[model samples]
Target: MFDFIRNHKRLMLILLALLIVPGLGLVGVQGFRGFFDNGANVAEVSGSKITRQEYDALLKEQLERMREMFGGAVNTAAVDTPVLRQILLDSLIQQRILADEAKRQRLSASDEAVRKTILEIPALGALRKSDGSIDTEKYHDLLAKQGMTPEQFDARVRRSLAIAQIGDSIEASALAPKSSAAQLAQLSMQQREMRELVLHPLDYSAEVKPTEEQLKQYYDTHQKEFETPETATISYAILSAEILAASITPSEEELKKAYQDNLATYQTAKQVRASHILIATPKADTVASAKAKAEALLAQLRKQPGQFAEMARNESQDPGSAARGGDLGYFAAGMMVKPFEEAAFKLKPNEISGLVQSDFGYHIIKVTEIKPAQTRPLSEVKQTLLSDLKKQQATQRFAAAADQFSNLVYEQTNSLTPAAEKFNLVVQTATVARQAMPAPTAVPALANPQFLAAVFESETLKGKHNTAAIEVGDNTLIAAHVTAHKPASVLPFETVKQGVQQKVTLLQAAELTRKAGEEKLASLQQSKSTAGFSPVIKLSRAGARGLTPAAVSAIFKADAEQLPQYVSAILDGGVYAIYRVESLSPLPELEPQRLTALQQQLAQLTGQLELNAYLASLRARSKVKIYATENAAASE
Candidate 1:
């Protein structure tokens, strides 16, 4: 891939320039002009200029895609610059690999194919009219709104199609068999049911006492476990979400107006429960056909309002709603499209609206009731308003004090006394472990990189100076000086004696139980009878009920040929269990739908595996050089 890119660099650059030149008028290529000027130009292949700017743009797009995939729940702080750079570089390398491969294979898409693919994309599709033909004016208007020209849009689509073609060819070759689907299904469907009995070694400790020498030896062997974990005494300032919320304070006038404007939102709208018969336009793109369909539906609705539900059940294209006799039960304002919402909201009780056009098609709405909106008095909302007001006030106060506090702490040099005195804030201390000093919910601003970096710095712990103030969250700041520090060290032997003794006892008990269970099972298998056994244990055909993983594992290991197999292992709640499988059953055959779904899943898995393999191959062949130190310095 690198060789191809290097050899065809000039050609690739020319092709890229040609492709993007037209779009430059709209997208402004100035931002991207010097993208590869300083950075090492990694690859430019087949008239495609893979510059730093281009890579960054792709990285941003990928991030946006991830945000969309996660429904916008991803934390911005989690997006590390180094990680994003690596991802972008890898993606660019893979594209170069595939592009080279495509060229070598002479894989190409025809003009017609490219055009068809572009037109089929929903973003590019023309708005539908009564007839099926494209609505040119609507398409033009949409392009104008997006600040793009048809030619530029088409060119962009062409490049996308080219990339997709290369990807598809590689993916198609990587497809695997559907039989894997059945295997996966079997694994997922496999389940075991068993009963368990647990025994604890501690229960028998009274009967067997260890010698003094043995106890001493155990204590000497394991000292670390009994010792406390390394601890740190930290001074922290907390900025809790609840505290922030409490700080806000809303004005009485603001509260009143907010309540009045959103009165409808507070009250439940009277929902009309009605069904409709829809005769959709044959071709929504053509004005004439849409008008005709609307007119015909209007005539039918006017003639017999009673048959609407029956007609909808018989003829509605919306199968999901049609199954319920077109019943769109009780929707309020904003529930439907603009046209439908307007029509529904305007109708009186038991009144039917004339034909209305929505994006879906045409609709005939019937009103079942006119539910009057409800309102609550100011007194009822007074408490809520007060809480909001307090939160606002707190936020403002915190913001005002943060800068002053930060300056005071720094100026104090080695003490939090100045800041504490200036703000009347308590200087709190924590005896938490270094690993746990930053509480799980500490504000990010308070735990900023500077503060964390300072914590690990030797000078900060020596009490040379107070650490710089850190912004942990909105309107929150923190600065700290470590009052005491304990360097990490191995614990003494005496501290861990009890823990070692407990471990030894548990190991010994497990060994004893395994041996005893093996002997019992062997005897049952050979004797074929419980005559000599102290107690004849009854085994259920389905094995034990409600068996845990540990118990089941222990029991399954017992000699199966032997009857009355008794194995005891520690289970939950200080108990042990033993069991034997009296019988085994095979799984039932797969149902039709399940089989089809499994096959589809297997196909998708195969595609993903192929893509992964291709990426791995590209990485292996590429002349990739990473200057990690240089990159880190640049980022810093």
Candidate 2:
């Protein structure tokens, strides 16, 4: 929620979108304790409390939007961190600060504007009357359901519009100098032609061999590299929602009752399997001519029912289905346009309709089949109904079962047997190697980082208390006790002697390669010509020579004042390469499109700078109060 504050240009823009501004993100309400009652608010803007309820709703909405933006690839459990929470809180606070400042500057939106904006919202405008005016009663009811009075909702809309108006004016006024565009283009497009000599670790490896003393010294200095990771064995009382749901049996009576209750949804509507012959309005012809052509085609279809498909193929303008005899398949009422629908529904099986006109032009339809409205019996939908019922019942039972699981585990402290017996759950056991070895994904219970920390904490490992129930996934909870812990220890010298020798040899080879590269660079700097180097060609700042990002960065960072510059850096696999800059070239001119892009980029930069400065000045002068921060709230 508060993440947008770092981006000053978009802060006000996003706030104006979701309101009272619903984009205002966080002030942790659940565990947060403050001077004010419940400490549910992060700040007060002109004495208006920004409640935790508002913060939570906005954050949740934004989080869902983010997941949606990523095509639902984001794992929700991994990213709900305190850092993100604080970022949201900051954004909310920033919005409040700006809103309060808007009030001070007498930025006001008229009531008419507020009303117009309100009516534009689908939730408010969906109940519009014939006069293109809002249904006042429904609008009031909508606000009531959202826990807001008319005045409160109205004032919020008015405030948001005013602030948005101010933001747009400020952004539009931002100017980018013409000279800056040319200069920026030059910096981004500069190219250097150079040739580099590459050296590999294998080249120096044959010359270097480590002595016994060197291997021993390397092993002792880098002892951490050889340390054996700690391992732990844990016992868990697993309360699985899936397992519980599968085991439970709902009586036949309950299943029947649920089926009956959902009977309305199983009722199918009246529909016809249809095919049409359409004479679409041609680009060169008028609608009247198209209708006349459709009438002539309909007359041919009426004379020979079997030739309807061939005639549709030869003359029908509805290309989507013309190849397949213009079959529109099965469609219920309300699926087709008014004139077309009225004509098609009045026909019986094997019956043909005359020319019917709609927005798509004229059509002649045939009723291939018709299905009257009917209710689906229990036999047809039993399995689906049973599955849905079982899930619903299991969800209801799990809530009560989870409370008992949490309580029994906490009350008994030393054992999981009582809770295991109560839920008919098994006390499962597993051994994990260190914190990083058995990845969190491998074990379902320890999927949460907090659970992993608790398992290794002094209380659970040494004090022998059961770790509190930690939520790892949707409808999943886990608690564990450390059965045994192996402390981390270093491997003895003899145990890793061969590995240590290999490390010492590589280290020596890498140093030799670096030294050789530096010498080569110095030699190249002295000689301006390509005496010993390979052919050098130009590579731009865009780096199109298959150069690694690191190599490109190194090249650009070199001192540009000197011609024929030289620099060397260690590459991947203990290799080294020396890059020599032969010459630098700048762009000739910025094209119209490039100039426009640069101008927009410059304008956005100036807007951000201006907005940030404005926010800073507002912060300095205002009585901005933060009752609680995301960090302080999360620590509890």
Candidate 3:
């Protein structure tokens, strides 16, 4: 049950939005019911409609999340596809279905459960007062950040709890039989000894020469690659949080007060390194038997303290740390459940504790080390505090300035100079395209799709006027005035002839290399020859050595039941590889911790399958309508 303590903060945000914020849905339902029937209704569950506006908003949020998850390396075009739109719409419909089902089943959580769950969540720890009660003011501020009120947040949390019950019931019923788990584990750990011979593309490059006709044909078929994108020279103005922050100066007294207000954030808590032996109290085990088993282990440890690690390795039920003799590593206060944390902190280094009862089970902990708490002096963190204060002030300033900036650009229309003068921003000029080229000198804000779209709008381009202000970053806005434009045009074949010949030659070379590799595989299968193969090496799903996943998969997919199996894999970088499977063997008995982890993984997989099937059944029983062209619900 304490596993919830390890839940990620991102998941908590997703959970808070279980079925859309109550505030948004309430407004939309109250005012847009008429519009829903004709204009923008994307889906509906029961009597509630999912508006196209809501769908688009959710899609944008999801894409932003993907961009954040990949550190902005995500390709927007690749992610924002028709398939993704349908998938997101289906997901929204499922969430609606679950919410309706919760209400139909009258699955609202008790006020006490809601209170307890909110307090238990580590992500919300900052919202708790010193007296162990919810900090009402802070809680309100937190909800307000998500555009929700306290009542709305509580209702959402309650609904999330109720929806969780549906999943919990299904997962609790899922059982992965021990035999199935072991068989799966065995297959995963099964090893193959193999040798490979590769055909390099370079080896065949001399055999295939590209003619001018072939190069022209290739160029004709792929003209888009040879065309220059439409480009424009524009003057743009940017109003950003950093620029605002640069102009603000905070007083020393203000900085000190800010530092004092967030003192907890600057203090390092005391940490403990400990090892534990847990006797888990599953539902199948009686409390008395479980505690009795824990007591027995404690008694044995008392008689032979040096045998703690051995006993823990043999008996601990926690899969995560059992292999390292139950070492839990270092953890600060609030990291562990209350009962366990209290007992652990009371112990001295090298001292052992008696059985301590917890939600998970009974834990016998041995403290190995302790790090004293520390507090940084104000002088040490003054610069950081000053920077944060300025940023805070700038954010507030930007919130007000953003509106004025938008108005100024929209009203002026002819030039960005007026807004630039008002905000003290420079009217910078850059050459840009509908798609920003990847170059060192390219302007980052110009790469934003919304900003670029505004720049390329028909009205803005034809009139040589300023585009409407668009948000390009956090508290950052951009407006551009088009000065010159160039239309897209294809390059002559003569201009790209050399590049086309290199491409055609590479394609031909790769094909020849693949064909040669296939012939080698056939020869090896018939002659049982190892003349051209590398030294034998072992491979398993768990360990692919340095080979690519595709190569490893091909090696395993070969008929390994019989010896001397041959397989071919076309790898990236225009290389083809042929492998000879020499032998196969089952791994030795798995390490105790690995075995436990595998069993847990198998159980989770089984539970996930069960959950998916349950959702499918729920969808079938509910009335879901998709107004989009795909109409995903009709297929279901």
Candidate 1: C-alpha lDDT: 0.56
Candidate 2, position 248, lDDT: 75
lDDT of 1 by residue, 84-150 (tens): 5565555565656555665566665577865665455555434754334456887878877655777
RMSD of every candidate to native, in Å, equals: 11.1, 7.0, 10.8
lDDT of each: 0.56, 0.74, 0.79
Candidate 2 lDDT over 1-636, as tens digits, reads: 443443444334534454435633343322112212456665665567777676766666665667778985554445556666666666787778777767778888888887767765655546775346666887778777666788988787777877776666777789998788877878778888777878887889888988989999888889999998776788986675776888777788987898789878999999999899887765546887887777777777777889988888888888889999889899888667778888889999989988787767888989999999999898888888877877788888887888888898899999888888888877888775546443435455554555676688888888888987776544567888888998889999999998997788888998888888878777777875566667877888766587777788888887788767887667787788888777777656669888877877798779868977877877667665555643543211
lDDT of 3 by residue, 1-636 (tens): 334522342235336455343234222221112212356677777768877777655655665567788996554434434576677777778888888887888887899877776676665787664336676888888878767797876777787888777777776676777667778888888999999899999899999998878888899899998999998999989898889998899998998899899998889999999999999987755778989999999999999999988888999998888899999999888667888999999999989999999878889999999998988989999999999999999998997899999999999989888898998998988888887665533456777656677788899889888898876655678889999999899999888888888889999999999888888878888999999889999888889998898898888888866878888888897899998999987678967687776676677678779989989999989877777654243433
The better-scoring model by lDDT among 1 and 3 is: 3
In candidate 1, residue 390 scores what lDDT?
A: 66
Backbone clashes counted, model 2: 5
Which residue runs does candidate 2 get wrong by more than 4 Å? 1-12, 15-76, 108-159, 205-231, 271-371, 374-377, 431-440, 487-509, 529-537, 544-550, 557-563, 570-575, 583-590, 616-636
Cα error, candidate 2, residue 548 (Å): 4.2
Between the candidate structures 1 and 2, which one is better when assessed by lDDT? 2
All candidates' TM-scores?
Answer: 0.53, 0.72, 0.67
| Predicted structure with the largest lDDT when compared to the true one | 3
